[model samples]
Target: MRSGAPIPDFGEAQLRAVLDAIPARVALIDRGGRCRYANRELAEFVGLTPETALGRTVTEMLGEAAGVLLAGQGGRALDGETVRWAGWLPFHNRAERRYVQRILLPHRGADGTVDGYFIFSRDLTELVESERRLLETGAQLRGSEALSSAIVASALDAVVVMDEAGLVMEWNPAAERTFGYARHSAIGRPVAELIVPPMMRRRHVDGMRRYMETGIGTVIGHRVEVEATRADGSIFPCELAITEARLPGRRLFTAHLRDLTEQRAAAAEIEGQRTRLHHVEKLSAMGSLLAGVAHELNNPLAILLAQATLLRDQATTPELRRRAERIHAAAERSGRIVKSFLAIARQEAPRRTLVRLAAVVDAAVELTAYGARSAGIAVDVTHDPDLPPVQGDGDLLGQVVANLLVNAQQALQDRPEPRRISVWTRRAGEGAVVVVADNGGGVPADLKSRIFEPYFTTKPAGAGTGIGLAICRSIVGAHGGRVELEDVPDGGARFLVWLPCEAAVEPAEAATPDRADESLAVLVVDDEPDVAESLAEILEIQGHRVTVRESGQAALAAARRTRFDIVFADLRMPGMDGIALRRTLMAEQPQVGARTVLVTGDTVLGASTARARRDGALVLEKPFTPSDVRTALEQALMKRDPPAS
Candidate 1:
């Protein structure tokens, strides 16, 4: 009961009292499994006094089942082995069940021989139940942590956790992918040094310090866009969201970030498309305005030319004749101006014809000359007589040429006083090339590749529509040609337009006999009285019976009353326009519709005219000479009634 202790010279009675007061049941057994000694707790648990229990064996004192288990453990101790065991078993003579733990130790004699064993047993039901509950709580906590880890691992945005010292504590899989850093490398590293750009590192560290000290954070609980550096030392845009969590004696920062490189590119693409659409709408509006202006100017020009021609033919004196001829020349120049407007406004499929490239250049120069002069830019022109003609749409080709010239002029607008543009045409292999070069700051090397892209421009904001070169390229491409930026050593931009050429076929001679035969009834319809009267006079002088109507309704009524041999109806007019009038005539009187020659001063109506032509109807553009008028009449008549073979 007592080891090497002589506290107050304790006697055997006092030692037994101490042993009996202890919580554990204590006993001593001999090698035969017979009790040699027992504590008060042990003796009371077996319903026996200590003296009586000392003479009994373990099986006789406890019971068959528990004594059999205890005997084996006691045997090991007796054989010089220490033993321990725990289980739920009956005690107090099998009255109740309780969990108990026991330790058995070998008792040695003075000769070092194991002759007995010592047993120390304790009832541990309360402690065991408490431990079982604690284990369940621990398992639940581990399951919760596993669920959180799974969530972080599967997230699309990067999830990063940093301690109060700004060192990384956790880096999820998304974080590894986003920052190009492995989890092993990122943990325990300073977060700022790992992902923050060099220029922003100091600010990031300062912000963390301020937040930790004052509990006030600028970016915490907010999402923001910032530049982040990758592991390879490259910077890119990133969207970041931070949340502050206060744990026991420490603060943690959780950051969610997403790379924005692709998103930003998509946004930029959308913005560019929006800009191109806006410019297209503006060009369409400009086309509409030009059409209106052409319509207005063609009426007066037609009247002037008609009157001048009659005056010149009837003049008796040379002075009067010269004046009339001069008037006619002025009207012709005005007619060219109107034609330029039509060329720009007309947007339709190409109409192929044998076109002289030099003539296209001349028309473009004429249209851009005044603007070039006002901008203090000099334009020089050159042409090679050997330049072969190309087959293409003249109006579209002229538009392409004009766009290049205007681009050159605008390019040289901010240049020095000697700003100059050189334009020339030459015959290349099976093609003709027109070169437009400007002596100004050239296009940047980086932009040359994308120069022809819609809405891609080198001009400052609001200075250029960015579609000119794109349109030019499209037109040239449609014509089986190509436009390219020719590198010039002189440090200015040069654009070359090369068009495919076909073998030239000489036009057969046309004999015009000064005679008018087979006179027919003709109707001229126009919104402008002058235009209608002038057209009527032209038809009358050509020996045709002419009728004039200032409105389409009047023209339609007159056509219904009398079967006119031919009808010339203006495309745009009040009430019913030429297109509607023609439709009615075609339904009511197919002959008159077939003999119709639709007239339009608005070349913007080119698309409509093109449709009319496809339906086997003839069309005449306004501001025409007597020759053009006669040609239109002949074509209409020829279409209405073919000559016998």
Candidate 2:
């Protein structure tokens, strides 16, 4: 039928012919469900001619159920409401189904009395089945969409979808957790601005634009590790895998991202462990070599000192006495140098001490200034006197300062006049900041990053080892601090060391002068015969009865026999190591074990250091002198009850 149109005239023959030839299932029924008129299509559906169908009631021609249903609809039209519904009508063959879309309208009499109904019916079997199939397909598609959404919601790795314009379209639950952004805020926002750091946002935007224009992308279809800024503005590392999809006239990108912060931390830890392992290995090799060298040199050194001492005390000639004094002084100085070498060889993991920055900086400056001023470099020091102390290894921090000072001095040496080094410490945030700047040419921007990397140096062969800055970084890192190079406005290089500040100062212990007076029996243990006897004789001169043992097994035998008041054991010896010997003594004779002195040039760290501290035994480094031996005995004596004195 036509839209917004009334029923056409049915009184004319031409109009009646039009209705009969309409190819629709058209019919007109009376108030009694009797057919008044039937089109060619309707007549065929009834298996009767239009003239014969007019006298039959619908309930008689069709079945009783369908006829009653039709009668109710026709009754509504009789009362002035247009009724439209899709219902099945029986075909001529009862076994066949006939579906039709029907409309019923009221036809009023000229006298205003209710008249019969006018029914217009249409056969929609083909259209109805097609819609049924369409509805089923739609349900399936809806289910698939729901499943994809669930998968995205439950994904452990973040999934993000953005449009060709780089605006976020869909952000899954994982994305929300990953970037700390709500889905509502993330969607419809520019992706580059949302998660990309400001420094990289321009590049991200340009790259996206270029890829959209040229169909070539660097990030698309590639998994890359990138720095992503979170909603809180904190940046972290993330691994991103992106794939591009083109739909009709639109393009979209889907990314799978995983946070790499923990992975990066674990990797750094592994690398640090590897470096420490290497350090230990090198320390071990050097320890053995130095121990042997110290042993060989100590025998002659002991002889020289003993002979010089004898001459100085008993000489009648004043000139001979003065000569012996010089010889004695030389031997003592050499002994100090050997002990310093042992300290280097057996470098222990630094024990943390609460110390002020000024003291540490002053100590380093005292050591660095002489050489610095010798090169005509003026040194200036500035400090914020109120700065708090930090919990760290003072010696290690001093080493860091030494490295920076050495680097600054070397830089100044090659520069023109007006060479100067400025060192200062100040409070910055929750940290103590130290800056060492020099009036030498500033470091190149390109080289600044590699300066702290191990084995990376610009100096000529033998002029410098590449490990200075690397060691500085390691030491600072161990203290939970940071060291970085910054640009100086004065056209100089400035290195900043940042150490975390402790909230409250840990009080320093009161110092007591050494009171190592009470001396008892002492044992000297070593694999070298001359080294052991020389150390014993030196102790014997200090008024302690001394015994010499050339091995850990021999030392253990001596301790078992005499419960010595003091035991000096070499770390590396035949049959048993110093650690094993000490353990056996500690288990059998706890009193003698309490006074054991273990000396080493080896890398005695970790478990060894822990055990040494636990046992309260002294571990003096090797390349010791007569004095180091006496000092050990005195400390052990202080720990004891002074031998009933």
Candidate 3:
């Protein structure tokens, strides 16, 4: 215990017991690298007893590989220096390697000189393995953090992390781009103040507070759509999802945000297209029904119109004439209504003709004036006498005018009384301009751009089809014209229709010039008995020898013997219709065929009718008056013997 003091000298038994109890392999080696003394533990480690291990060299006790490491340390100790070496060594008794720490201290004689050294080796395998595992775990954690940071940086949606107090803790690159803020400016700022819209900021703060206090979140773990504000104060629709992360006593929230502006626009466009498609399907079905109706009703209506006209012309007295005239007038009105329905059906292609703009406006006004008056809205119409005619379909142009008037009337439904609509036509440049103005609320600013779009409407649901303006634009466009809304200064709105003017051409007047007071042999062919009888009577009254046939077969039989000056045939018959009858007659006698006239009640022509017309066979649409009948006869005469041109 004291320096330079050797007190009691224990026997070898006491020394061996002390060395064995130390739990370390202890040995003494002389300067020649051979073991001089060994404790019980050191001797057992090399598979030898204490007496057998004595006087063994380092290489013989451990292994050649183990001795090489210890030889250097022992040589250094012999040179009067204490040496420490720690490494893996395989001892003679163990098959596996052991991590050992060896300390070699020099033991010198009483004189200041180097001597043999003592060796102390302890096992440190478990401690070294634990330290190595700790280092591996640290590397794994760092790698995981790096991967998370890279994903957040490259994510398409905005990634934002906020602390418990709602201050932004992490602002990824996507967040900076989405919120219009740089990372430096966003971090440490209240996230709600940065991206939450002004109207939603209070709600966001309250939600965060509630979650922090009660641990309940309304938006957490769920995706929601909300309005978000940009740095420039613009608000946009944003899809957001939030997640809560709790560490120890602190809470953090991560939000993922995606802008929904384009997505919402696309969805709205698809809906509009769907509505338009549905409307088009309905219109197509309605057109088919109207076409069928026209075919069925025109036959009876034609008989009524022709009979009334003939009876009026052949009336005996004043009273009979008046009654016949009234019947004829009623039939004419019915015919007009049918024509209007045909126009609405849109079953026929537009027929281009020199249309008087003034007449079209007046007719449209008269057609809709009753509805306007019933709604307590006064109507005013004026047309310029000097306005030129436009080459377009008269019925279609009238429809366009009527649609404008009806739309104006509907616009005035919710307005106060004393409402009025005014229509005016004038000559502008080389075109005719018709302006329809109404004293009602004008179109909204936001709806102006989409008003012409199919299925877009401002009228209350079920009250409007939403295709009125779209149809108007289409008709006008087809006619090489344009319709537009002209802003009214005071109130209401003005709709202007501008159509290019065309030189007017008068309808040809058909007259029997060669036989002024003479009648020709005429044959009338019709499937209906009344129709054929009425037409025959009309022809007979004109001093013509008329023959009535109920079917094309009957007409063909009669026409074989008689060289009829003209043949009148109904187009749509039960058997051997007009086209077939005409073809057979032309094969036999080209003159009679050339003078043939085909009549029908159908407004929509078939391909056969079209072919007949192309062959120069005159066709008169049904519901014909006495004048129409005369025109057909004269046209057939002109075709049979064209004037010597």
Candidate 4:
């Protein structure tokens, strides 16, 4: 290009083309505040041709005030600073006025001094309107969070906040009361260290760490029931919820906790009362059962004993001796009845063991077989070969089966057709079932519903106590099983008992004692001379020195004086019962109190028995045999110091 000639440089044309291609309006203003050059977009934006815009000062085109505004902006641009302004500006051709943004950028000469200004203006009316809407939206969001916070604080449940570090960040008023800590005291403390029980603290910390790392949670977003400790060092139950929250730079957790102390206590109280009511009902039924059992065993025993004595006096032949043997067998059966009653009423804890269902069924059948045969009833038993062993008390289960069989036989006595009592045992899914069915006149539909209810017997006043079925139900329930009655298709009623089966357990071998000729002094205390003398006789037979006292006070006095190796005292004696006497003795000589055994006929003293057991005293029910007395005495004596001479 020539130095000062007007050259058609392709580079300048390309720049012009690029500027004209821009969507935004573009213009050029000289240092004197005159519009020197305008691009096509700017010309169209102002509704003027580029030739008309050229060499026009702002005052000549728009007026004096507009001219001064433009001149000031040009001066700012000439000072080498970009000037930007945006507002509403009127267009000559556009019907409606609109908002626009004007950017003024200074252009420099070859000497690095500002020569002119390049201005670009964009119509940003839509963008400014959108920004206004966004500002309103932000205000709404802030109001929503405030409202939510207020609602959560007003909730009845205790609210707490913790940061990702598991430190308490906020504690509400409800939380203070629930945790027995003030808000000021709880804030900034490690949440797990403060609220979690010692045993669960480490687990809670680990869970928090895991959740933070993998976004995996066990309790988050879910409500859970757990144990909580209060500031008083007392533990209580609680329901809790944890939720995750996002913060600007970290994560947080909000916990809602509800105290379940009162709920749990009320539930426990109701359960205790229910158990007590059940026990009371059981005792009432037992009273009726005692009456029935006594009635059933007494007549047979009197006949057998009387006949045996008569035959002993009048026998003259082998046939008479055979009859006497029959009398003896009958008496033995009566004795077994008494034993069963004693076992049912015994205070001893259940001895749990694995017992074969078949063995228990066979034994029970044998017990009632003679009576059923005598009543002209045919007995049938069917056992599944695949039946599994059950964990239970063998004697108690045998009693249950015996009771069921006896009830069945009694039901069929007046039946006209073939009287049949069938007992079936089979393996059920995941359990075993024992069914006792009778083909007698089926239970009256009305009576079937009440058969298992305590004291609701269908038999004539003296024949049944109505407790057998109830006891069977209780026994089955205690084993975590069920007892139900099903209707037989043809006739009669079926009682099905389902019990969980367990692997067979081998019986523990009896331990042999070392031979030692150590003699122990034993004290026997009872109000009844017969009972005291019986116990004394048994103790003496066991090679122990024995003394008898008729009252608890007397027993206490004797214990203080003699230092006996063991004291077997009747629990219900007059003037200081076993508990009071034991307490007095314990206060005086704990050693003697520890060696004491409580003997009573009343098996229904629930809390009294519980307290005695808690205090380490052995309880024995009455009507015990000589061997029973001997074993109890030996065990108690072995637990005490040697008796002084």
- lDDT tens digits by residue: candidate 1, 409-479: 98888888799999999988888899999988998888889999866788898898777899899989999
Please list all clashing residue pairs in model 1, or write none if there are none: none
Displacement of the residue 399 alpha carbon in candidate 3, Å: 2.4
Ranking by lDDT: 1, 3, 2, 4
**Who wins the lDDT comparison?**
1
Question: By TM-score, who's the top model here?
Answer: 1
TM-scores for all predictions: 0.65, 0.43, 0.65, 0.42
Q: 130-197, model 2: which lDDT tens digit per residue?
A: 33443344345653546556656666678787888889877899899989999998889998888899
| Model 1 spans with C-alpha error above 4 angstroms | 1-157, 165-167, 171-237, 243-251, 311-327, 504-522, 540-545, 551-567, 572-594, 605-608, 637-645
Over 4 Å off, model 2: 1-350, 354-390, 409-413, 416-437, 445-471, 484-491, 500-516, 560-563, 604-616, 625-627, 638-645
Clashing pairs in 4: none
User: Model 4, 1-645: lDDT tens per residue?
Assistant: 122222123234545565676656777777767777677887766667766777776666545654666687888888998887757765545566667766788865434567687777767565444434433443457435454455455656687878889898777778888888998999899987778898999899899889888988889976577888888878778878686766457776778787877655544543344344445556667765784565345334433444454454457998888887787566656655555554555556787888899988987887788889898888889999978799998778887898888888888888876888889899999899999999977777777778888657789965865678898989888888988888888998788889999965666854433322356787888887766775676557557798998888788778878977677887776778888887787677777776788876555334566677777778875445444565665556556543543
What RMSD does each model have against the real structure? 32.9, 31.5, 33.9, 35.9
